[model samples]
Target chain A: MNNARRNRSFLTDEDGSAATTAGFVIAGGLTFILLAVVLFTDVPIIGPNEGEMAPNLEGQIHTLGAESWTNFELYDEVDGTWDAESNPEAKWFLIQFMDTDCPHCWNEAGPMSDIESNFGDRLTMISVAVSLNIPSHDSDREEVVAFQEKASLMGCNSGNSDCSTRSGEPHDWAYFDDLDVTIMDTWGVQGTPFIVIIKPDGEVAWNQGQNQGQEIMEALVEMLPVVEAA
Target chain B: MILSTTVVLVISGLTILFGALSRTEALRPLFSTLGLGSLVDEPISRRMIAGALGGILGGILSAVWVWVIQRQEIIGSTSLCIPGSGCVAALSQGSSNNLPFTGLEFGLFFILLFSILGWIALTLHLDPKASNALRLLSWGRILSGAGTAVAVWMTIIHLAFVDDSPAICPVCLVLLVANIVTFAQFHLLYTSHSNGSWNDK
Candidate 1:
């Protein structure tokens, strides 16, 4: 009987609950603030963040007149270790992630072709075609070829019979087929018409995702050397 | 993966045995019928519950840190998922449609839930005489059991449904082990407290 009474008294004490509650409250509040800051801040670490080394991209390259798809690795042509000052031939790379079905990509096709025509001497442009995984937004190798051909028709080369003429200039660059969509995931591309400008040294100079409400053309014009009048 | 899963199952089974045998007299006859009556009288320590809670808290915090790194796009040589690894593939598979944010939200929810439960359990353990402490501790046991169940179910989903390839999230595996160990500890606490064995210590 005495033991039972001692146990009952021991189970009713309220000594340290207040301190525990206060500690938890403070810790929880601090954790919340930390997570919020992490989510909102622009930390350049990976996934197309500006000033970071762009992730390596590889895909199947389909040229406008090619008989078969060929392998393409971005880093193979634009060496990550190549310095512009050491190698004057080092060319800037303009990578555009697009879907054949996206309307924004469709509209940007002409402007992108024009950019390639104007800056073809100083930079290399490549269009990475990907599927958005939505209804009617899907694309394949044939669709990629067709999209590039259409864009090419807008260029100075109007002799190609394979493509229907569009409003934009013809695109002379290669169109890569991201069949597995791995490129999209690597770059953290959320939507189509995503543009990234890689410096000659392979560092990401500009990422459209990081610069919301800004046009890729505006960024390119500002960053690229001014075209001299003949 | 098989070895770890087997170890977790064995530990969980032992936890259930101790939980069933330590307190209720009704379970005594059931164990006796199976010639396991001798195990019922075995004395178990309550001190391990604190250790188990500590492990859970640490494991959850580590997982939250990984989640933060992933969300912040802080990928480098030291990141949890390297390029071309299973972790990267799993992350890529879920990147569509803001799915990573959903994962972050869920992780935050678990952190809050476990943190609150750990605090309550610690308070009850330290001040067993606190008003209604025993009752609240019992609720903690139930909730911890539920939390463990959720962890198990998620592990199953990750193994069977996440992808065709066998991809394991190391952080997720740590969370599972932590949840199971904490649940077992809670059971041990219940066994010791109900029989008044904790007071002897």
Candidate 2:
């Protein structure tokens, strides 16, 4: 009996052609839009934001620290004067960009000193502190002075080690005391513990943070052979 | 990274425009999917969903991005993508500093905005296929809740580790927000907004 009732027409007499037509139109429309956006931005200038020669930093770089950095002139600690010329010296130069207030940087100072001492013959480790938003020359000196004083206090004097309390790691004071701190920027840093590795040709090899011990070690070991041959 | 981000941005932008103008009802879902939920309603849930989805998408995007950068064959030990270092450093890089708004943090905002557009459309039963105006949000309002989280993540990677300086591509950030927003939108639409309206126009 139920089967007999079900035999009745399921649809009303109307054909409902409009509904079917609407469905087809929607399907076609959807296909077209997806296709359009997919192709448009591919135009040379509009789509991809690629800029000139992968800028020392990507084009948007207003500030350069960590790995994306290079400068024509620099200051020398031993001579206590400006280098004026950026020389493509040793096979590799470990340039660490530091700031006056960076505590993480001080923490990495030990490993950095180790990198310098162990590889001193083969590599050169130097630090430059850059500040942000402080452009005037006068303010620049004050910033540098403040940074140097802080560094001296940390490096030369043995204190309560409040700075080293975080990890209970021993502070490397003497090493940093010998090395000079140059102010690369004024006011403050865009970010810190900014370290860069430059190749003999003066190209930035790597841009990154601290504690890259094994990574740097392995790289240096492999690199020595190539440098020796050249 | 650049190619993938570009491709998705283009696809989504065109589909969004199409959704606004198309007359056909059947095509709505496909275009809407590409739009990723321009048809639902819900503020909090949408962002929560977008941020969560953005994380997964960010992971995929990161992997693909690192692969492409590596393929460039630029010789140097890339610190960010060197095995153990990978894009994980982007997390740390965020801590080192702050960049003025670069539009990358807009992902979560996009999610919320998309969801809100869906909510109002569903509630009003406007043209089932209507497209919303471009979303506008203040930095402060946008940064309020979930945007803060994405910002935090982006901040860490940008400052402590990653390069390209927290340059948040608007398209990728929008797409990222859309993915999660759409997922939540579709789910809520089917469950709650369904009987409410579909052909209200």
Candidate 3:
């Protein structure tokens, strides 16, 4: 049988012993060299390449038009729809692309809430928090929720006393969980706290840089009628 | 998840080690059922095989722990819902985002490198056609020993020094046993060979 022959040959293979002894010496030598290298040097084994640049679209102008807003499927905060339709009562939209940990995003919350309250029914304000990979901060969903809670952006404390005691107009807050920033890319948002005002007809009216919350609202008032007419 | 996986791998390593040391023909059947019979063919080969398996699993599990702790950096977004909104948004520069070389990632790479070396050693042991089987076995022993040292060092640094845990991890303790047995088996083999007792077998 093949098994018997294999067993007999395995026991009688005298050449293997000498070769194994040689292999031992070579293996010992190689291991010694490897250990020395490990002990002496600092090696980078996993992770991103060095000198990578952070994506910053600060001060860049976007030539976006009304036709551009047709297929944006922002993950819904309520219905969980990928392309959740906006409320019919709302005529205009103020979309703010922001990083949850950005100090400027935190600072702009008050001004945005003011605009939401003043424009009531005339305009819908949505804050889209983007996750940023900074050295100290990990801007993710938990951090997004925490930031929303800290700033009361979820309108939890808004006029409605249905859920609990809270204040402020319940602003729409949503984000994309698909890991694709096609919406952000389409808008040419390079920096945090980027604001874009869209007319009811899906035409972009305002694309402003960071830290212009007050100016944005003032500009919105001027453009509201024009957006409504469209 | 990482913690649970580490526990399972550690338990598997222990079973292999215990079976090898006992060398009961009864244990051979059990080991064969698990696809590890040839591994315990002789006193020398058994320890090397166990050490290699332990190192491979330990290296992978520890690396997983590193990834788990830094999920935010790796995946951009988590399922944790915001209190007021139904929206979850994650913005990153690109896929290149978690690629920055960090200590944890680097440690994982090192563990994996040594684990590969341990596998190479295992391969040499099983290769009947290999003329340098004895020499390769020595190398395999060294590789396993080195891998075990790095694994233990990393575990100590991560759990004790870096994370500042009060006790050593049970998984890490199991790896430590595997490491100790590897060296013990190597010593026994060397002594037996030197005394010409190995030839009697």
Every model: iRMSD: 6.3, 14.6, 11.5
lDDT of 2: 0.36
Could you report the DockQ of all the candidates, in the order they appear? Answer: 0.15, 0.04, 0.04
- Candidates ranked, most accurate by TM-score first: 1, 3, 2
Which structure is stronger by TM-score: 1 or 3? 1
Q: Each model's fnat?
A: 0.23, 0.00, 0.02
RMSD of each: 10.9, 16.6, 16.1
* Candidate 3 local lDDT, B1-201, one digit each (tens): 244544655554655365235434444455555666664455544534444444444443443333332332222232322322111121111221122444434334444444454454444444433444455446655765675676566455545443123333443444455555554544444444443334232
- The runs of at least 3 residues in candidate 3 whose Cα sits more than 4 Å from the true structure, single-residue gaps closed, are A1-230, B1-29, B32-107, B128-131, B160-201
Would candidate 2 be rated incorrect, acceptable, medium or high by CAPRI criteria?
incorrect
TM-score of each: 0.52, 0.29, 0.37
Fnat value of model 2: 0.00
**What interface-residue Cα RMSD does candidate 1 give after superposition?**
6.3
Q: Is candidate 2 or candidate 3 better by lDDT?
A: 3
lDDT, candidate 3, residue A45? Answer: 29
Worst 10 residues of 2 chain B by lDDT: B131-140
Comparing 1 with 3 on DockQ, the higher-scoring candidate is 1
